[model samples]
Target: MVVKRLSALKRFLIGRPLKSNELGEQKLNKTKALAILSSDALSSVAYGPEQILIVLVTLSAAAFWYSIPIAVGVLVLLSALILSYRQIIFAYPHGGGAYVVSKENLGMNYGLVAGGSLLVDYILTVAVSVSAGTDAITSAFPSLHPYTVVIAIVFVLLITTLNLRGVTESASILAYPVYLFVLALFILIGVGIYNILTGHVSPELHTPVGTPVAGISLFLLLKAFASGSSALTGVEAISNAIPNFKDPAPNNASKTLMAMGTLLALLFTGIVFMAYYYGVAPQAKVTVVSQIAEQTFGRNFMYYFIQGTTALILILAANTGYSAFPLLAVNLAKDKFIPRMFTVRGDRLGYSNGIIILGVCSILLILVFKGQTEHLIPLYAVGVFIPFTLSQTGMIFKWVREKPSGWMPKLIINSIGALISLIVTIMFFLTKFAQVWPVLIFLPIIIYIFYRIKKHYLAVGDQLRLTTCEPAMPIEGNVIIVPVAGITHVVENSLNYAKSLNPHQVIAVYVPFERQEENDFEAKWMKWQPDVRLVTLYSPYRSIIQPLLKFVDTVQRKASESNYQVTVVIPQFIPKKGWHNILHNQSGLVIRTKLLYRRKVIVTTVPYHLTK
Candidate 1:
């Protein structure tokens, strides 16, 4: 009854189970695919420019003007990544992204490095995006600032539930908010631009001036560039999930990738340019986008609308992680680098285990970092850029090896992408090493674990292989043993089942706490004795399973001398109510658990149902 109620609740939450035939229906069209796959990259504009200004402002207020050049730098990186991943989409349409590209072209070790990095990146994407979304909420309602961690976790759970409803369903639900956010940002940018051109707003009046902490240096500019490059974090997601698209999956996925890249470039560039023109700087309480919205529209409906949609899109950006992580895990699982459970689809035809695990891990990051976006940001891009480097490098190898038409162009594109990605990865590591050291430590450990899991699976396969084994032959005889607590209906049921086995011998064994009880039990057993022999053992330590195990071993040794197999049958009573289970001793359960690993011993349970 309890199981039935729980199953009903699951159906209500996740919708009805999807059949295998319905799986194709779950594939997304390009529009919904864009929303699900690109939300992370699109929404990063909300914070990416601000992250640049954050580093620049540390030098002096005047450094805010440097944001345009840094934004251009990030844009260049974004373009290279887009082109490189498009190549990946066409080459490996079944998807696995960097893991597949690296493993096939480079080697297994490099592939594990890429896989581990992307897995870590996806986890951080959920953590950072949701936390940033929560920041948007608190920016609109300062009163909610104190509950940041709670709000972030709530958004994580909400996105997790939506994704668990199946990919197509979640894409439909999440698509509109993404479009709304794009409209909001475009409006803000257009209005801000009109105001600037018409002399309604001036940079001199609104720009902030800060105390100069240090003079601008090459290191400072590279740090700012690295921070802003986070805008490129989600570009690989489309390539990672080509199979999630509808028919002509690879072509559809490539179109979505192009659309996402164009929108991301426009949005990211517009936001950064607006921030510069409006003289906006990062604030402790409000976001740069929120600040720009307020300045462009005042504290009006438009300002609130921008904040609302920004929060929504940022939260949904985690859908990218939700969409990609499970697919990547499935790839790793198939290769025996992770648990095979991740390969199983759930009731809704989604990778439920991976989704839930991602959600839980994201929630832990939120709690650890107290849902602070800035705190989590330092650890964010390192994981992503490492894979970007490996992927482009792998592509370089592929183009050189395959040398298809236009291979030189492909090789050059990936070469440039690889060099830039390698540089950005180093910059992130050097600049944010204090905060991101944990990720650096974690990557090697995870790669090692992947190797260990592969080794274990290989060992298990070797042991289970049938080719080296001899053919089976029937046993000469069977010896059955039944353990009884008392002369009850449950015992009778078990004894009957043992006799039905037609064994060469059947023995009923009982352990008693006291010697007197043992003698009494033996006398009673002799009188009530069916056709089976009765054995009574006094347990001086008052342990039931241990004494029974000793007697079973003794019987097995004697039976083996005659080429007989041993079987133990125990009786268990089924309680009428779930709570009634607490009233019973559960010795049968304990015996079954203890005997599970006993070599060549067969154990079976005979259950007697209790009505009351």
Candidate 2:
């Protein structure tokens, strides 16, 4: 009844279990897909402009002048990426994303590099998005600043729990917030543009941020471009998730991808334009978006509403990672690069284990970084460009190798994408080495780990491979031996089962500790025995498994010499309550461990259920 109630509660919370056939029924339409997968791209407008300003402001207050130009570069880079991925959607509709493209075209090792890069980027997405979302909230309620880390962790847990219910469910739950955020931002951009044209913008904060960097170098602008590239974090999510869409999956997904890119391009352009128009810079107490929001909406209810939606969209943007990471993990596992457990779907037709892992990892990152969004952005920004370059280059190789109709145009676009992405990755790394060191160090370790996992799985497959031949006929002499501790109901039950095997011989072996214990046990066994042979072995070391193992080996060797079979029956007591297990020693477990690798011996366990 208790188990049933818990099941009921879980089903009520996460919904009833869906059959394997229902997986397709749970797919998203373009609208919800846009909402779920595109939130990161859209919500990025909230922070991308600010990251650029944060970098440029270090040189001089006049550095804000370069914000639009930096944003234009990022958008152009964004367009190249979108074009490259659009080709990927049609060619690899099954949805392995960069991992598939790289593995298939660049070779297994290179593919693993892409997989590792995406894995790191996905994890950092959750951490950075949750922290940024929490920052948005705390910006509105300054008193909540002290608990930002805790708040960020809670938000991660919430997102994980929601995603566990399945992708369509999470998309539905997240769609309204994404739409609200986009709507609010579009309105803000429209009003801010009018205000900018009319020269009615709000003045800068009375107490401005300190300008740290003295002069602007080529390196400085390049670093700012890399920083602003945070906007590109989730551009590949839809491409990675083509399988999650309804029928005509790839087409719907591609259309959705284009829609997302257009919206992101527009919203991002508008936000950066408005930021520069209002002369807003990153301040100590407030965010650039908030400053723009206050100026456009004038601290009215709409302003707070904008903040609310920004917080929601940021938290849900982590959904972009939650959606793609599991699918990529499953693909890697399918290729034998990772464990096969990730390939299994859960009760809700979701990759529940992957979702749980992503959540826990992000929470740890939040704790380690103390939920500081600015500190995490640099780490995540570098990870995005790795997969970006890999996927684009892989696609270029694809078009060149295939030479399908009109492939030349795609070839040119993707080549440009690959070069731009490579430059961005190298520039980002040089610009933020101190901040990106941990992720850089982590990447090689991840690649090594992937290789190790693949090696282990291959070895395991070799060991488990089956030979094709006729089965060995049953041996004339079949022997059954039960390891007896003493005469008890448990031993009697196991002995009876052994006898039921109808073996040519049934023998019970007892390992004696003390003389008196052995004598009493033997006498009791003789008196109570229905009909079974008894044997005894003396142990000087007081090791039960060692002597029993030797006795079983001897019987097996004797039987094999005469072409006979032997089975070792072990009696185990499974206590009803978990704590009750500690009351008894686990001798059966010890014996099984000793004989685990002994192919000559066969061990059978007879579990005696303990009700009390």
Each model's TM-score? 0.96, 0.92
Question: What's model 2's TM-score?
Answer: 0.92
The runs of at least 3 residues in candidate 1 whose Cα sits more than 4 Å from the true structure, single-residue gaps closed, are 205-214, 470-474
Candidate achieving the largest TM-score: 1
Question: What TM value does model 1 have?
Answer: 0.96
Candidate 2 error regions (>4 Å): 202-214, 463-477, 535-542, 582-584
lDDT of 1 by residue, 1-612 (tens): 888998898888899998998999999999999999999999999999999999988976777878888888998899899999999999999999999999999999999999998998899999999999999999999999999998899999889998899999999899999999999999999998899899988758534444244587899989999999988889999999988989899999999999999999999999998888788878999999999999899999999999999999999999999999999999999999999999999999999999999999999988988998898887888889888999999999998888899899889889989999999989988899998899868888998899899999998897777975455546898988899999999999988889889733888889999999988888888888756888888888999988899888888888778878889998998998788899889889999998888887899999999998
Question: How much is 299 displaced in model 1, in angstroms?
Answer: 1.6
lDDT of 2 by residue, 1-612 (tens): 455778898887788889999988889999999999998888888899998988888876667778777888998999999988998999999998988999898888778888888887888889999988988998888999898988998899889989999998888889999999999998889988788667686545221233333576888888889889988889999989998999899999999999999999999999888887678879866888898898788888989999999999998899999999999998988888778888889999999888888898898888889988888888788788888899999988888898999989999999999998998889877988888888768878988888898889888777666764345666786799898887788987898798888644889999888888788878888788847888888777798887887888888888898888888889987887766767889878888887877887788899998787
Q: Candidate 1 — worst ten consecutive residues by lDDT sum?
A: 205-214
